[model samples]
Target: MPPYILPFEKPILDMEKKLEDLRAFSQAQNIDVSFEIERMQNKITEMRREIYENLGAWDKVLVARHPQRPYMLDYLAAMTTDFTELHGDRVHADDRAIIGGFGWLEGRRVMFIGTQKGRDTKSNLERNFGCAYPEGYRKALRLMKLAAKFGAPIVTLIDTPGAYPGIESEERHIAEAIAVNLRDMFRLPVPIVVVVIGEGGSGGALGIGVGDRVLILEYSYYSVISPEGCAAILWKNRSYANRAAEALKLTAPDLLKAGLVDEVLPEPPGGAHADPAAMSATLKAALLRNLEELDATPVEQLLEQRYNKFRAMGVFGEDAAPAPAASPAPAS
Candidate 1:
């Protein structure tokens, strides 16, 4: 299958194609071109570095949305053992977009939950392009409650454009489903770790994003609104999505600096899709380390800190307007 080429990746792809042709020609003619191949390889490395090193927020968005980027199941397979999937909200049908189950991470048994996006057209349709309905949120909460009941820590992977916004979603009360999760997650006794592994869009991501340690992959974005959605609303055109991405400060680094994200996990060079195994390893280590830290705190203290962590995120500042001095004098 052909790779999904983003707009900015065209140059890099062109260089790689030339390098491939050179190698093939050398082999066909039975000639030694190893020196040239090495030189070209070095050039390609620098090319990738230069491009990735200076990526803008919009560029990072493209990378985050890349079709081949590792999803929740990929991370689960890489980081856990003894995986067992649990399904259904018990009140509604099972939602495939948001999947959760029990998995052994490192030396401890933990509950794993995350939004899953599909790899192809068929799967995307099945996953509804990673948009969850009310049942998805309810199912996630059910899983979390189960984890808490078992005295196990909870790990949530977030990646979605937003909650499903179709008519059926409203009919099922999507907002209420997410609101309940947001409220209940804060009160859960077990430690919860949330990772924004990809496009963390609006209430979709937030439905299950609460936790003690909120981490984000370097290229992933977490925002109340997607850039395109914001652009369409604010600029009246989706083409201004790039500008909206910049203004939203949704990138991992941006969110970290703004105190919205606890930490930013650096992706493998050229982004996560370029080296999924490496990215997965980094994610595994981070999850274990954060989980270890949370485990050390008492349950009461953990819940307190978890609530405060999110509370602290809503920091607001309002400049008090100058009193109507002139009007007061006139009244006097």
Candidate 2:
């Protein structure tokens, strides 16, 4: 029902509809097209593989921001148990943009943090379209501290256009909140995992994004700024965002190759929106694998690893470390 569905999605949906109709026809008329159904199913699988294999960076960005793409709440509903939501920054009113809670995922006690955009018109307005204010970032900092204090591993879901840049947010010290999160995140003692489930825009995304390991969904993007903002600043033309997106190196594959993210979890064919359950399953497995590796690490080691992971990214000039050689060393 969302507007951004790719052209390929239509035929896939049409084939599925036909299959459903055939099932109904068989029940009603006592006719069997079992062989025909199997053939059509194979065709669907082939089409899906082709479509998923060739998604461009821009297409991936659009898929990441798809209106129907599953958000943090969807993941929580599907994967977590006994979710106890925590609220407020203690110094200010609670922010809905960042949702924090203690929850159990696959029998592991963990703290969940994420930016939440509203799904519909009214909820979107209520959530400020996932744009965090200073209070939201501050609240996230508080939750991260709680997770560390309780020794619970943290799982953060990033999905936002950016932090709110309105007058009220400035009054509350937006930059200060984000800076504090980044500064404190490096010192936290537990395993921290960040997943860019959708748009990872600027400090807003990074406010809760610092972690021991970062994973991006197949179609998601992690960028220092939005493509439109980058275009306006660089060329003074907003229409050049597509070009900026290409040059920004913001897609999952680009970031992976650049060594900015730890892993890229594949999404379902036609993007996560086309098959949320499958996407969630894939993400859960990735999360579990990362958590398993991070769980046994001591708090001090976790902090050190996280600090080094971020500190090593984007160093410039003579201070930058040499990249690994094209061919790996021969086994001893």
Candidate 3:
């Protein structure tokens, strides 16, 4: 299949194609046009840099959802070694939407868990488009507990539209499953690192999102709710998703400024999809650095700091002056 192209990327791709054709023609004619081709290549680089630098929230949203973007399994394959996938929740059937197992990272044994989206239509159906059902969350929690017990650090890669909203998921108590993971993750004695590799939406992402250090990729988004869902709820139309994205402050810079994310890993020139190996290298370095720092802390201090880290999120309007004792409302 041809590579997917976003509207904003058309011009860049077109210029690149034209440059390639020019170079081919030059070679065919046995002419010396190396200088000219180099000049055009430089121009294309500058244009791409400018476009990526000034991308608006909507552009970022599209990038985050780009079909070619590397998914969880992609990262795992690129960044880890000796991965042994363990399956089934034990209480229910295994969910393909979320997968977890033990892996070797920089010579350290760690538990790797993430929401898995398929690369094609059939696999996407099987994975429910990366939206986890209740069992998925249960399985994640189970792996996390095992990690904690065995003295393995936990690494969670979040990329999901949201938790599955199907009636069957609700009937199975999806919310409760996610909530349990949230509560248990905080208390784990081992170090935990989380990265938002792509679309981090709502409780689906949060189901495995809690960690000592939370990182987001440059173009990835982490939000309580997806922009399209928010648009539908507020304006009764999904087309307003772009505006909704702006309003939600869900971008990496926004979240970093708000203290929701500890770090933002830079992506390749265009985005992660443009160069998965480069993106994976950056992610691996950041993970190893953070994990090293986290490993040096005492378990007591680690747990306490992790607790305070999450507790510090959100804005609390400065304590309002206590209202003057309700002025004798009883007289009425």
Candidate 4:
């Protein structure tokens, strides 16, 4: 199959095609075209670097949603060992969209939870395109609670467009479920690490997003809503998604500047999809480093810091007059 191409990737893709044809001709003719091939390869590398260096927020969104970008399972496979998946919320049916289980990460057993999107039509249908329902959140919370009980650290991978918006999802109380996760996660005694691995959209992402340290991939985006959804609401036209993406301040660099993310893990050139193994290695190292730091802190202090970290989000204006200083205490 032809490699999936994004709108902004046309130039690179065209060059790649030419390179492929050149290689084929060179092989067919038994010709010595090594010099030309090397030159073209260097040019392609330079072009990719130029294109990725100055991407706008909207361009980052496109990279975050790239078809071949590594997802939760890919990271799990690369970073964890002795995996064991746990299913169901017990009170409701199991949700395929959000998966959680036990895994060993760098010699420490941890609970792994993440939104899972599929690669093809049938799989996407089954996974609901990574949009979770109430049960999914509940399942995630269940795993979180289990991690705390076992004194295991938790690692959550976020990648979702949003929670499922169907009437059935509402009826099942999706909002309440996510709210409960947000609340309970704050109180969990074990260290928790959250990573925005792809399109972290709305409550679906937040359901498993709260943690002691929140990391975002270089090309990933995390926002209260998807760009398309924001465009529809603000402009009544989804075509304005590019504008919405810029306005949302959802890119990794933006969030890092705003102090919303603890760290931004760099992706390989051309984005994570271009080199997933390298991306995974970098992510695993970051996770282990942060987890070790958190593990060394007292549980009470960790919880307090986690609470304070989230409380500090959003803009807050200074008190208008600094509340006039208390009148000089009575001398008498």
Candidate 5:
């Protein structure tokens, strides 16, 4: 009944509305409403299943960046018991774009690092709209190293458009900072689990994305470049972003098929924003499952596997080699 509802949520909401109307009508007429309610309930269930089962790539992107989708802080509040945030990169002012510190999830001490995008306009501006700066990446590196030293397994929630590309960030060496984090996280002597909780754009996501096990939410995306950027580069037109999105294979299922992500964590019907609590419960269970498995493995083995996991990505077979430009046909 609400305006601006996503297409995937429309059918489910429609079923609910029908059930309500049926109840109201039956109550006014003093007739049996139970049968009608049951039928509507079945339709609701069927619609939910069908919608989620056949989400297209663009629909998945919509879910991933859903305005109400559970962000990092939402997940932390729902799942963590005690959270004390640590701040500062030590060499510069604090970057609100990143939040990291120690937290207790399911009674286990874990270090959490994540990009935080605010929920509304004012807050979004304060958080740089989820774009990390050089200092933010540096702060993440500090927390990661501390977690490794303290023997706490690391959990990183990735949700960013990309790192900031402002002149200030460039002056501060954003690229170098991101590169350092990528290098350090790869060999950290501890278990690292990364969840692409939302938008995962370019190097900003990968800077802190190294993990023993990498999981992507069913609706989240991970791409070397955002669709807009890819379109501008490949088609010389920003309007081709939709086409680029289709060609880039940036959705969770696409990444899984490409061997880029280890697992896909299912979201609530519609998206995580539909039910933050339920989404958090699902993610908490997923983390616990992987942590248990990682806990049982020898630390050395875990590190080796993590390293090998990344090494195996982007491997191309002989068919991957680009063919020489086709020779022009003989002149007519």
Candidate 6:
């Protein structure tokens, strides 16, 4: 697929195109325009910094949804030595939307699971655009149990917009499946680390999201609903998605500040899609570091910590006592 560019990234692309054309022209004419090429390169570098540094919440949403951004399979391939994909909930058909397996993470045996999205129309249809049904959550819970049974740590990558909202999903009791996973994950005996690699939307994300450490990529988001979904409900128009995104507190920095996530994993300067290799390396290091920390803690303490971590979320400030309304404004 061709590179997917966000609207605000146009300036950087424009400069890059100019630089490319200049290099081509100089080479074709056998001219030594080294000074011009170097100048253009420097200018493009500065432009990239300026644009990426000032990205708005909506811009981040765009980045998180970028098709070229690395997916779960991409990261597994880059970070793990060998992977054997496990499928199905065992009671139902295998859900392609949720994939899990055992992998060697730098020689350490670990169970890896994640929401899977596709790159094209046919694949998207097959993956159901990463919207898993009840069976998908069931499969994820099964994998988590298997990991716990073997005393292997679990790592889950999240990037789905949501669970499938079609009638078939309702008929299968999607809510109950996710609710069961949420309850079961807290009691599991192994370390579970969850990462929001991209679109962490609604119950779909939380279905497999409970963990000892919850991390989010710099340009990724974890929201109760998509900005568009929120806009449609709250503002009566999807065009207010940008406003909704700002108000959602879903960005990595916002999530960190709100205590919704434990850490914010910084992505490549222009976004993960700009440099998948670097993003994968950063992700591998962070995962290893967190896993090492979790490994040191006793299993009992680990479970307590995981439970407490999520329990402490959504703490709200109490409203100040309303000054008695000045005794009804002296009705006399």
| lDDT values for all models | 0.92, 0.88, 0.94, 0.93, 0.88, 0.93
Q: Can you give the TM-score per candidate against the true fold? A: 0.94, 0.89, 0.95, 0.95, 0.89, 0.94
* Model 1 C-alpha lDDT per residue in residues 72-113, reported as the tens digit of each score: 999999989888999999997899899999999878989999
Of the two candidates 2 and 6, the one with more favorable lDDT, higher being better, is 6
Point out where model 3 deviates above 4 Å: 320-332
Q: If the candidates were sorted by their TM-score against the true structure, best first, what order would they fall in?
A: 3, 4, 6, 1, 5, 2
Q: Please estimate how well model 1 matches the true structure, expressed as its whole-model Cα lDDT.
A: 0.92
| Residue 124 of model 2, lDDT score | 96
Candidate 4 weakest lDDT stretch, 10 residues: 321-330
Worst ten in a row by lDDT for model 6: 323-332
Tell me model 6's lDDT, rounded to 2 decimals: 0.93
Task: Kindly list the per-residue Cα lDDT of model 4 for residues 1-332, writing each as its tens digit.
Answer: 35788777789999988999999999999998999999999988888888998899999999998879999999999999988999999987999999999999889999999999999999999889999999999999999999999999999999899999999998999999999999999999999999999999988899899999999999999998889989999999999999999999999999999999999999988999999999999999999999999989999999999999999997977867754566566678
Q: Mark the regions of model 6 whose C-alpha exceeds 4 Å error after superposition.
A: 317-332
The per-prediction CA RMSD against the true structure, in angstroms, equals 3.9, 7.2, 3.1, 3.3, 6.7, 5.4
Could you tell me the TM-score of candidate 6?
Answer: 0.94
Model 5 root-mean-square deviation: 6.7
lDDT string, candidate 2, 77-181, tens digits: 888888899999999889999989999989999999999999889999988999988889888888888998998999999999999989999999999999998
lDDT of 2 at 175: 90
- Candidate 6 local lDDT, 1-332, one digit each (tens): 77777889888888888988998999999999999999988887788777878889999999999999999999999999889999899876889999999999999989999999999999999999999999999999999999999999999999999999989889989999999999999999999999999999899999999999999999999999999999999999999999999999889999999889999998887889889999999999999999999999999999888888888777768998889966578656
